[model samples]
Target chain A: MTIYYSEDHEWISVDGNVGTVGITNYAQNALGDIVFVEVPEVGDDFAKGDEVAVVESVKAASEIYSPVGGKITETNGELEDNAALVNSSPDGDGWFFKINISDSGELEGLMDADGYKTFIAGLE
Target chain B: MGAVNNDLLKTPLYSLHEELDGKMVPFAGYLMPVQYPLGVMGEHNHTREKAGLFDVSHMGQVVIKGNNADKWLETLVPGNIIDLKPNRIRYSMFTSEDGGILDDLMITKRENDIFMVVNAACKEQDIAHMRSNLPDHLELAELNNRALVALQGPMAAEVLARFASGADEMDFMSYAEVEICGATCLISRSGYTGEDGHEISIPAQKAIEVCKALLSEQEVEAIGLGARDSLRLEAGLCLYGHDITEDTTPVESALIWSIGKRRREEGGFPGAQIILEQISNGTITRKRVGIIPSGRVPAREGTEILDSADNVIGVITSGGFGPTFGGPVAMGYVDIKNSENGTDVFLKVRKNKLEAKVSATPFVPQRYYRKQK
Candidate 1:
């Protein structure tokens, strides 16, 4: 599986046509403590840059944008009870949803691991 | 964010906040920390369970002296300043001519002078207002050489007693001069968090030393404005700008308790006619009340509140996730008819209307320490 990141700080791990999406570690760190996670429902279709989820922190609520065009296949139900997982493990068990890719070409616009590292460094 | 300009003010602990990896933000023309590495939720929970130290030096502190100080102050607010005993603090507000709140503040009556703490953003206006209305005999002096810090929580007194003697003997809303870490400071047994805590005023040059000393204790940790805001919100306290703006009146904001009994009977302060009339006639159109949304989605400021018929009844003034309540708790104004406890309401959150209820304030029960007679 190869992980790709978007400039908006969303990350997606791709395996075949299925891609699991979540926010990057940098995004969670900047968001502080995650109190609520509004995940996209299964079968919800979204294009790149579409607001698909909401993550509410103690200070403010922020929207999580979709990194690529796809239909949500499954959402991580554990987030409803344990939203802090996003802060503890942003890119692993904290995945927000899994999406079935509608078009492989949409993934081309996202950055690879090294490119994302440079992108985040530029933010500082 | 980085400092927008060189003109912004810096607190005495600015470097210490930076060293602790605090995310600095510009607030009320001062570069201050909004959150540190512990995060807002962590800081908030820590404050409820242990203790949190907040750098509130940005707030304006002023001392009023002279024989006519109490009489001069009565012209500004509706609180009973003349009857306030020495070393006791009273929560009050500066009122406008039209019965609106100019700014809320804490007034401490000392034996020789009156000490006042006002909001940072309104400090200039407050000073100008007081100066223009001052009787020549009364002198108002701003304490620019002092830094204020609030140590709050259930464990606050225990940690504070370690440094300042006689801290444990102070009841809620009491003030005294105490020695802490070799510095003589003015300490008040009061805080905005609705918890047993104290606000200490120290010399600006020695602020860092005092703060470092307190933070070295096991129960104390440095908190930021973000957690301070959440804690105050959970405590059902008003945020000066957001909750009690100049457009809102004290009676309408549900702060009628702050008005003294004598002031309510024979009123002479600004807007006394309107406030006194509202108190007796039951003519207040709206009232501020606590709001509890039924879901996890935090209803934030500006969220519209609706009645059962879908009519916009009011708007949220302060709303957020309460760390102790483990749910979304908010405070907002509603139509006076709909402001009763347990009244069902709806919050328009994005595309959905979430169910909410009007509840009694201090979403979590206040843990203030009251003296047992």
Candidate 2:
């Protein structure tokens, strides 16, 4: 429940270096209906802004950017089988993957829960 | 020139789509519904198992009225048009004199007018073609602003029967003038999903009333372009830009059924010589077969189909994971010999040769109602 946010609309909470990440509800609503989820393999390292995943809705394919420099520790295997979960619970059970953050200091630049809420609200 | 002002193309049911949280996309210059919150696969499966409604307002509606309308139109298209009964629809194609398909269209005979529907993107060209080719006595009235909707799936007729009284009386390919929700419009018993459904053409202002009346039924749900694509694919129907084009002749695309018996023997429309010759002598090559990828990965358009020896034989036209079929399906051209029912083939997918097989079309069986009478 240690909600940390990325400018890319992804968020995570860390238990030591191991953390869970998923897109905000705003991203899911904007994407409109998750049809397919393309996830990177476990142990794949990614830098911020690197395309780590692909989510396809009905008409378009959206790229999910890495929220922080991290090594993939685990992925939501359930999404591979049931992509619709991302649409139903984007923030909770639909968390895309678990990444082990390579640097905890990166959190200093990320948005807090209150700041992300304000940022999202301003978008409308 | 219209200057591509898309704001004018909104349908009467636009607000309803927004209410259902439909994702909009720009198609044929109109802000259109591509999918609802359920996405393409879900909507497609729902249509197969239940029912779906579509806003097809982009299609062109035209009326050809004159003493010689039928006789004149017969010269342009390759259907038995002059023989169509007053209320029946006949599927036909406008041919270039050299035998290329200019465009495919549907024609209906009214008391004093011959009404027509053409693809949304090609309407301007179609009207222009008809105007120049048709003599001065024949008048072409383009109803470009009308809105059309297609109620599809097995339960479609049941839903439409509530508002359009006496809807069940019509059979497949039949249409008539019907009053729906206190509005007069043309309702046709034809659709692109290869199912027993109806295509309703109404004035732009009255379209929403019809949509509301149909949506009132618990069995009806609004569908978008995403599901529309998959449903048509599952039905083995062709999309204009993907499955067909002007450069591709009708013979090679396996559209011989559209060519009538008399036209085949008499040879009057465009490209009659080449078309008739190919019919008997066999097309130099034919578009045939379907492909199902082994994995969940979908082979999109332009993906190469190869033989065991790695020979690029054909190109994939339309490919995606079908909701009803429960797997990825693709349609493409293949050599006639390898186009048999169960031939093994391979598709090149992102550095991997995925196992695929040539299978017959309509991966999901169509559920359309038909009446003998």
Candidate 3:
């Protein structure tokens, strides 16, 4: 499994043709308390960089974009009842959706874990 | 984006907020803490359950003195300033000639002068308005050297009583001059949050000392602007720029109660003609109403309000998750016909239309401390 990060602060962990996506820990921290989340339905097709989800914190709402072109396979429905999982575990059980990758080449545009660390470091 | 804006002014407790890991954000031309490590929801819940200390130094504090101060003030606001007893506080607004609200403020009649607190964003204009209209004998002076802070919640009275004698005994909307941390502080048993609290105006030099002492209390925790917003929203308090703006009238905003009965009959304030006409004829086209979204989705400010047929009827002015209410709570202006309690409204949040209902507010029952007879 390989984890890639988007400039928008979304993270995708790719394994085979499937990739699990969620916001990074840094993104969750900046968003304050998670109150509501609107996830994409399963089997919804999206192109790279399309807005696929929305995360609403106490302050404001933020959009989550598709890291790469893909069709959503599953969504973390647990968020509908308890959105704080995104704040407690942004990378693990807090995952937003699973996408079946449409193009392996699109993953090249995202940053590796090491590169993402550097990118986030510069943000501070 | 993490870098602080050098142009923004810093309050006296800025360094203390930084040391406490507060996330500083630009607000009303000042570098104010939006939240601390506890986050907005936690801070809001803590404030409701225990007590939370807030640094409100950014708000504008001013003193009005000299001859006929109350009479002069009565000309600007619709509240009955003449009848307001010394040490009593009254919520009022400066209305425009056209019945639009200029700004909402707290007026405390002191021994020899009237102390007023206005919104930070509208302070300059409010001061200029008062100054330009002042008579030769009247004086309006801004309290530039004071830092205002609020200790709010159910435990607030107990925590404050430890530092200042007679703190807990003060009635709601009453004021007193008390010595806290060796400084003469103007303490008022009033706050935007629905919970029992006191807003203390301390000398700028003694702000940190007083705040530190308050935070040392077992029941008190440092809260930030984020929680303050949610707390006030749940309290059914209006935010100046959002819920009540220059374009909104007090009658339309459902703040008609703040206007004294005498003022309603004898019109004399800026917008007397227009506001009084609206009062007598019930001509307010739009009225503010409390809204509770049926689902978890928050219908944020500017979201269009629609009827069952999808026709736009109103707009949400303030909306967010109410941590204490355990769901989404909002306040907005709707057509008078659709402003009845329990009226169903649809909120256009993005492309999705969320179901919501018009309900009465102080989403959580107000817990203000009022002395019983």
| Docking quality (DockQ) for each candidate | 0.90, 0.35, 0.89
Predicted chain A of candidate 3: TM-score? 0.98
All models: lDDT?
Answer: 0.93, 0.80, 0.94
- Tens digits of per-residue lDDT for model 1, A3-119: 999999999999999999999999999999999999988998999888999999988999988988899999999999999999999999899999999998989999999999999
Q: In model 3, which regions exceed 4 Å deviation? A: B1-4
Best by lDDT: 3
Tens-digit per-residue lDDT, B95-198, candidate 2: 78667777788898877779998988888999999999899999889886678999988888877887876786678888888888778889899888867789
lDDT of 2 by residue, A2-42 (tens): 78888789988778777788998888878766767888889
Which pairs in model 2 have colliding backbones? B98-B271, B99-B271, B196-B368
Please give the range of 10 consecutive residues that has the lowest summed lDDT in model 3 chain B: B1-10
The numbered model that scores best in TM-score is 3
- Provide the lowest-lDDT 10-residue window in model 1 chain A: A40-49
TM-score of chain B of each: 0.98, 0.94, 0.99
Alpha-carbon shift of residue B117 in model 3 (angstroms): 0.4
Question: Model 2: residues >4 Å from true position, as ranges?
Answer: A58-60, A100-110, B1-8, B16-21, B37-42, B97-99, B286-288, B335-337
lDDT of 3 by residue, B1-373 (tens): 4355888989989889999999999999999999999999999999999999999999999999998899999999999999999999999999999999999999999989999999999999999999888786887899999999999999998889898878999999999999998999999999988999899999999999999999998898999999999999999999999999888889999999999999998888998998999888999989999999999999899999999999999999999999999999999999999999999999999989989999999899999999986
